[model samples]
Target: MNKLLVAEQLVVGWDAPVTRPVSFHLERGEILALTGPNGAGKSTLLAALAGQGRIFSGTLFRAAGARLALQTQGLPPVAGLPLSGAELLALTGASAQGLPPWLAACLPLRLDRLSGGQRQYLSLWSVLASPAELVFLDEPGNNLDRAGRAHLQGALRARANAGAAILLVSHDPELLPHCDRHLMLEPIS
Candidate 1:
C-alpha cells in the first residue's frame, strides 16, 4: 500500500508519555479511527502526528512531501470576527461545491452569526476539503447535529476515496463503520 504515516512503538505526550507505546500505519485512500476513553491520548497522538505534541519514544514517519491539515476540538476564536464561511473556505483553499444546502446558503453570512453546529461543520470542511494529503480530526463530531454527523461520514468516505489518509479521533460509534480500520489507545498508569 501507499503508506503516508507509520508509527512504530510510538509514545506521545505533553509533559511525559501519556500513551502506551502503540504502533500503526496508514495509507492513502484509507480512514483510520483512533479510539479510547477520556485521557487515552487520542488527541495527544493526533497532535504528535501533526508535529505539535512530543514523541517521547519510538518513531513516526510521514511521506516526505505530504502536507497535512488538523482540526482540533472546540471552536476557533473567530466569533465576532469579520470572516464569512466562504472566506474561511477560501483561506483554506477548500471548495464549497459539496456543502449541504443550508450551510451553503449561509456562506455569505459572517461566521459569528451562524449557530455553533454550523460553525463547527464549516471549520471541519475547511480541513476535510483542503488539498492536504493527510487529515487529522480530533472529536470531529462535537456540536454536530444528526444531519451534520451523516454529512461528516460521507465527507470522510469521499476524502478517503479521493486518496487522502485521515486519522479520525471520535467517541461516536457511528463513525466507526466508515473507517477502514481502528486503533484503540490505552491510558498509562
Candidate 2:
C-alpha cells in the first residue's frame, strides 16, 4: 500500500498494554502529536509502530518500501564512545545543515563530550534529516533551551515541508503548537 501509516484501535505496552486502545493515522507532509499524562503508553505506541514492542491488538500499516526512523526518549548511551557528531550523521545518511549552527560547528567533537542539549539536538536532527518517510519522535524537547526549542519548531516545519510524516510525543507547550493535530491518550487506572 502507498499509505504512510494507519493505526486502528491500537493497544500497545511493554509488559502489558499501557494505552487504552487508540487510533490515529499519519500521511506524508503531516505532523501529529501524541500527548497525554505520564504512563499513558505514548512511548509504547511509537514502539509498536516501529515493530519493536509487543502489539496486543489492533493493526499498524506502513507503506511498502517506506523508510522509518524513531527518536526514542533521552540521549542514546554513547558515553566513552569515540564517535563524532559529523560521523554519526554521516553514518545515518543525514546532513549537518539540518542541525543548528552551534551544533553544526561542533561536528568534529566527540558525541560523549558534548553538552546534554547539544547531544539531544544532534540526535534529533539526525532522524529529522534522514530519508525517513515515517519518523517517530518521543519527548524530543527534553533538554532544549528557548533557542533550541525554536530550532525544533523550524525542524518540524522543515520536515513537513519536505513531504515527511512526523509523529511526535511531547509535553512542551512550545512544540505542541507546531503539530497539525494530536491524539490524546487517557491514563488507564
Candidate 3:
C-alpha cells in the first residue's frame, strides 16, 4: 500500500528539547492504534501528526490529497452556539448521509442538552462524513457506553472499508482489537 503519512524522528512535547525523538509511518487503508500511560505524549503526538502542534525536530510527510481529521477527548457542551448539528457537519465538509439516525433526530436540539455520548458520536460522524484520507481520533470512546462504543467501532470499520486511514488514540483496550497495528509510546527519559 502507498504511504499515507510519515513522521521522521518526531519529537512531541511542550517542554524544550523534546523528551525524545519519535518516528512512525502510516499507510492508506489501515488503522494504527496509539496507546501508553498518561502523559506519554500520546495527545501531543496526535496533534503533531494532525499539524496542530509544533514538531520539535524532523519532518512530517503527508501524501497529496490526504485530509486529516481530529476528535478531541473532552466533548465540551456547545450549548448556546447558533450552529445546528447539520450546520456543524457542513462545516467539516462531511456529507449528511453519514450521520446516525439518533444524531439526526437530535440535530434539532441544542448541543448543551445532548448527552455526552451523543455529542461524541455526532463529533465523530462529522469527521467521518468529511472527505478525509487520514483521521485522528483522540480517546474516541471516552463518553461512549458499550452500545455507543460498538456503534463508533462499526462506523470506523465502515470508514476503513471505504479506504480511509485511521489513527486512533484511546485508553480503552477494547479498541486495540479492531486496529490493524498498534504503537505504544514511551516517555523519553
Candidate 4:
C-alpha cells in the first residue's frame, strides 16, 4: 500500500498543545480509526494533518500533494443557504445511487429540510465521493441510525478499496470493524 501520511512525535493544538507527542501513518486502501473520549485531541490531530491547526512540535509528512478532505462534527443546518441535498452531492461529484430510499429522496430537498441523519449521511457521502486521497472524519456516526451506519460502513469500505486513506473518529462499534487499524487517544492533561 502507498503511504499517504506520516506523523513523527507529532503534537497539535489550536492555541496551545493539546496532544501529547504521537506517531502514526496512513496508507492507501486502509482505514485508521481514531478513538477516545472527548478532549483527547483526536480532532486536533486531524486538524494538523489537514493543515488547519498548529503542529506544535515534531514532524509531519505527506506523499507528494495528498489531497485531503475533512468532515467535521455538528455541521449546522444551512437554514437559508439555498442549497439542496442533490446539489450538495453534485458539488462534491458524489453519486447517491446506493443511498437508502428515504435518504435518496432527500437529494432534491433543501439542506435545511433534511433530518439530522440525512444531513450527516449526505455530508459523509460528499467526502467519500470526493477526489481527495486522504479523508479525515470526526464522529462520523453522529446522527446515523443502524441502517445509516451500515451504509456508512459500506461506503468506507468502498472508498478504501478505491485506494483512499481514511482517518476517522467514531465510537460506533459497527463502524470500527471496517478499519484496518486503530489508535486510541487519551485525554490531554
Candidate 5:
C-alpha cells in the first residue's frame, strides 16, 4: 500500500525538543493512534504532521491532497451567529441530508447551544465532507459519551474503509480497537 504520511527523525515541542527523534509511516486505509502522557508531545506531533508546527530537525512527507481535521478541547461560544447548524455544515461542505436522526436534530441549533460532544461531531463531519485523502484528529474522544464515541468510531471506520488515511491523537484506550497501528510518544529529557 502507498504511504500517506511519513515523519522521519522528528523533534516536536514548543520552544525546544520535548520528545526524542520520532519516525513513523502511516499507510493508506489505516489508522494510527498517537498516545503518551500529558506533556509527552502528542499534540505537538499531530500539529507537525498537520503542518501546524515547525519540524525542528526532520522531514514530513504528506501525500498530495491530504486533509487535516482537528477537534479542539473546548467548544468556543458561538453566540449571535446568524447561521443554523445545517447552514454551518453546508458551509463546511458537509452533507447533512443523510445524517443520523440524533445528529440531524442538532442541525437547527446554534453552536453555542450544542453540547461539547455535538460540536466535536459537527467539526469532524465537516472534515469528513471535504475532499481529502488524509485526515488528522487531535483529542477526538474528548467530551464524548459512549454513544457519541460509537457514532464517531463508525464514521471513522467508514472513512478509513473508503481509503482515507487517519492519524488520531487520543487519550482514550477505547479508541485503540479501531486503530491499525499505535505509536507512543516518549518525553525528551
Candidate 6:
C-alpha cells in the first residue's frame, strides 16, 4: 500500500492530552505539514507518531517494515564533540551533493565550528537525505535564513518527489507552499 501511516483520534502528550484528538494519514511521495500555535502540541503529535511520546488514547499504525527518520528541535551540543558535518551526514547515509555552496564548504569542519544556521542545516540534511521512507521533522526551518529556507523548500520537494513521505512541523509561512497538505492542531482547553 502507498499509505505509510494512519492515526485515528490520536491524543498524545506527556501526562495529559495537550492537543485535541487528531486523525490523519500519510502516504509515500507526499509532504504534510503540522501547524498550530505555540501550545498546540505539534511537536508532541510528531513524537507520538514516531513512537517516542505518550499516546494517552487512540490508535496509530505504521506500515510493516517501513523505515523512518525523525528530526527534532534539539541539536546535540557540538561543544568539544569530535563529529564533523560530513561525518554526521555519512553516519546518516545522506549525501552532501545537494547542500548549498556555503554549507558544502563547511562539511570538512567540525560541527562546533559552524554557525547556528550552518549546524542546523547540516543536521537537517542528515535526516532529509536519509533513505527513510517516512521522515518526521519538527520546526525544521528554525535558525535558517532566507537562502537556507529556500534551499530547504527545494530539498523537501526533491525528497517527496523521490518517494519519501515527509511530515514536517513548521510555523514558517514560506514552507506552506511546499506541502501537499496540512493538519492543523488546536490546543486542548
lDDT of each: 0.92, 0.88, 0.79, 0.87, 0.76, 0.92
Task: Return the TM-score for candidate 6, rounded to 2 decimals.
Answer: 0.96
- Candidate 1 has which clashing residue pairs, if any? none
Query: Candidate 1: misplaced stretches above 4 Å?
Result: none
lDDT by residue (tens digit), candidate 4, 84-133: 98899888777777677878877888998877778888888887788899
lDDT of 1 by residue, 1-189 (tens): 499999999999999889999999999999999999899999999999999999999988999999999999988799679999999999999989889998999999999999999999999998889989999999898889999999989989988999999999988988888899999998886
Whole-model alpha-carbon lDDT for candidate 4? 0.87
**Model 4 lDDT at residue 165:** 94
**Selected candidate, larger lDDT, 1 vs 5:** 1
43-145: candidate 6 lDDT, tens digit per residue? 9888888888899999989999989999999787777898999999999999888899989999999999899889999999999998799999998999999
* lDDT tens readout by residue for model 3, 61-166: 9999888888767764587777677777778888767556767898866666788788778877787668899988888888778877777777888888888889
Q: How close is every model to the real structure, measured as TM-score?
A: 0.98, 0.95, 0.90, 0.93, 0.89, 0.96
Q: Which pairs in model 3 have colliding backbones? A: 94-129
TM-score-sorted candidate list, best first:
1, 6, 2, 4, 3, 5
Model 4: residues with Cα > 4 Å off, grouped in runs: none
- lDDT score, candidate 5, position 186: 81
Which numbered prediction scores highest in TM-score against the true structure?
A: 1
TM-score comparison, 2 vs 3, better candidate: 2
RMSD of 5: 1.9
* Cα misplacement distance, residue 36 of candidate 3 (Å): 0.7
Error of 2 at 53 (Å): 0.9
TM-score winner between 3 and 4, please give it.
4
Q: How far is 86's C-alpha from truth in model 6 (Å)?
A: 0.9
